[model samples]
Target: MKDEKTREAYWRKNLSYLAILLSIWFIVSYLCGIVFVDQLNTIRMGGFKLGFWFAQQGSIYVFIVLIFVYVRLMNKLDKEFNVNED
Candidate 1:
């Protein structure tokens, strides 16, 4: 934040992280859970259809994992930018 160039670079990295994380979430929740559900359904998991599992649970799990991933990434970014609270 001290320098304009640094500020811009920090913001760009932040946005890049958001874009990548959101894309992953979207692909998991939409593509795997819905778009490819039929193909996934052909597979079985613990007596449940893989596609159904994804539509109902897998996406949620992946989302939670992604959230942690984002937090970790942001924390690292913050440190790199000299903006971390710790």
Candidate 2:
């Protein structure tokens, strides 16, 4: 009973984090890369156009960082809930 509720709460928190991270990923990958690309292209990132870099490279980097962030967040959440695998 209490354990089930705790599990549900943890899963809900996990899903919320997933939603937020995925939304950021979508915005960076699709919106920045394609939707506002022309506007972004007006700016330079290093030697490359900002939009091009986002489409070609930046989004991938952001995704990788987000993966780490999600892992860290989940670890903290697990600890807080006393559900950590360790």
Candidate 3:
């Protein structure tokens, strides 16, 4: 009853975070890499075009950072919901 509802709520919140993060990943990797590449190429970043950098390195870096951020956010969420594994 209450426990099931709590679990569902937690899962919903988790999914919401995933959706937002994935959307950002897609936009950075695909849109910046290909779709808006011409526009992004006009901007230089450390000797590389912005679009090229995002395609080759920036997106990967962002994904890694997102992983850490997700872990931290989930830890806080778990604590808030009294579901911390610790």
- Give a tens-digit lDDT track for model 2, residues 21-46: 99999999999999999999999989
lDDT of 1 by residue, 1-86 (tens): 35999989999999999999999999889998999999999999999999999999999999999989999999999999999999
Model 2 lDDT at residue 42: 97
Q: After superposition, how far is residue 41 of candidate 2 from its true place, in Å?
A: 0.3
Pairs in clash, predicted candidate 3: none
Clashes of each: 0, 0, 0
lDDT measured at residue 66 in model 2 versus the true structure, 0 to 100: 100
lDDT minimum window of 10 residues, candidate 2: 2-11
Model 3 — TM-score against the truth? 0.95
Name the candidate that leads on lDDT. 2
Report the candidate with higher lDDT, 1 versus 2. Answer: 2
lDDT of each: 0.93, 0.97, 0.93
Candidate 3 — which residues are off by over 4 angstroms?
Answer: none
Candidate 3 lDDT over 1-86, as tens digits, reads: 99999999999999999999999999998999889988999999999999899989989999999999999989999998998999
Residue 60 Cα positional deviation in candidate 3, in Å, after optimal superposition: 0.6
Best by TM-score: 2
C-alpha RMSD (angstroms) for model 3: 0.8
